[model samples]
Target: MRIIFAGTPAFAVPSLRAAHAHGEVAAVYTQPDRPAGRGRGLQASPVKLEAVARGIPVLQPESLRRRSAQQALRDLAPDLMIVVAYGLILPQAVLDIPQYGCWNVHASLLPRWRGAAPIQRAIEAGDAETGVCLMQMEAGLDTGPVLLARATPIGAGETGGQLHDRLAELGAAVLADGLGLLRAGIRPVARPQPEQGATYAHKLDKAEARLDWSQPADALARKVRAFDPWPVAEAVVAGERLRIHGAVAVEEMHGAEPGTLLRAGREGLDVACGRGVLRLRVIQREGGKAITAADFLNARRDLVRA
Candidate 1:
């Protein structure tokens, strides 16, 4: 079988590699290099870097809607196309080029979370479990029919970064197996996504990083975990910016006003929320590195409620 792979970012690299193992990978498509880093040098996407290193042909088209771009893809004469985290939307003409059709490895189960940022949204929503799905593509959003799926429990203390890495690996395995079945001339039957319980996983926003003490402590803790590794959860205290890295929610019979510092000691900086207490275990002041709550309190003696 000949396959054309389209993807970008680190999450997509594993799937690209797995796709290579099944058959001849005709070509790879990834987003164009963009300016990055302190010096603002052009940086190739992770998938592009990997594809080049493996000697696979690479394409970085700005748009596939153009007939020329679609013609270039049709020239590949691939049996199937595998897409994972490919930032671009495939026009219907391109989706029709491959015999087996385009398939996507989505981060969440079908019909549940069907958009960008599924991993973060799942943790933020406090979902008990989440999984990956292999779906046959259609024009509608992530409304494709699912051909295969693998479920996993979301750990209570899991962060978005952790779940992202785990799901990437799981998606690779599932994709490889799916391709194996295809090679054996078995056309996997795909089931249509359920119409009910459908929800969109909106892209993460910077505003969501700001901690709202008025909300429950548990919710705040989840935000800290969900926003990790990007726009880290933050708080404003005494006109100073603080990045909150770790915290725990505790039941409080009677807590102080929201955002009030109730105690500052080795146990952690216990802050009062609307209905519970939040023990901030790790924190970093603006222009400073992360430090334990107790250590930060030691240096800023004024933070103690004395």
Candidate 2:
């Protein structure tokens, strides 16, 4: 089968490898290179780099909505199209060109967390478990019938980056299973997502990373986990802004106002929340590397409780 793989970012790299291993990857479609890093030099997408390394043709069109772009994809004569975290939207014209239609490797279970930033949203929502779904592409955003799926539990202390890496591998494994079935001339059955329990995961904004101490400590802790390793949760603690890399909710009764520094000890920096206390384990100051709570306490002797 001639496969056309479309994806961007590191999360899609594993799936791209799986598709290439399964069948003939005629070409790869990814967003155009964009300026990145402090120097702002052009950086190619991870999928594009991998495709080039494998001697596969790479297509980086601004949009597939254009007739010329759709025609170019049609010219590839691909038997199937596999999309994983591909930034561009696929039009109906492009979807119809493939013989087996387009298959999307989404990071979350169907009808739940369906949209951009599913991985982060799942963590932020304090979900107990999240998984990947291989879905048949449609015009709507992530509203597709699932062809294959794999579920995994969300660890209590897992950060967004950790879950992302695990889900990326799981997605590749699920896609490989579907591709194996196809290679044996068997088509996987598509199951339409149920209307109930559908939640849209809007893209992550830097503004949401600001930790609100007035909210429940558990919620703030979840946000810290979810945002760790783009925005890293930020909050003003003792009149100084710090990025929270690791935190946990403590069920301690506190009369102090929210965001008040309750204690600083070898364990962690405990701050009063609306309902509980938040113990920050790892933190980083502006233009500094992440440090443990002990190190942070040592640096700020003033925060140590008498």
Best by lDDT: 2
How well is each residue in 1-306 modelled by candidate 1, as lDDT tens digits? 889999998999999989999999999999999999999999999999999999999999999999999999999998999999999999999899999999999999879989999999999999999999999999999999999999999999998999999999999999988998998988888999999999999999998899998999999888888888777899976457899888889888563679887777887877788879888898898889988988887887887773
lDDT of each: 0.91, 0.94
| Candidate 2 lDDT, 100-207, residue by residue in tens | 999999999989999999999999999999999999999999999999999999999999999999999999999999999999999999999998999999999999
Structure candidate 1, residue pairs in collision: none
- Once fitted onto the true fold, the runs of candidate 1 whose alpha carbons sit more than 4 angstroms away are none
Any runs in candidate 2 off by more than 4 Å, and if so which? none
- What local lDDT does model 2 show for residue 18? 98
How much is the lDDT of residue 85 in candidate 2?
92
TM-score of 1: 0.97
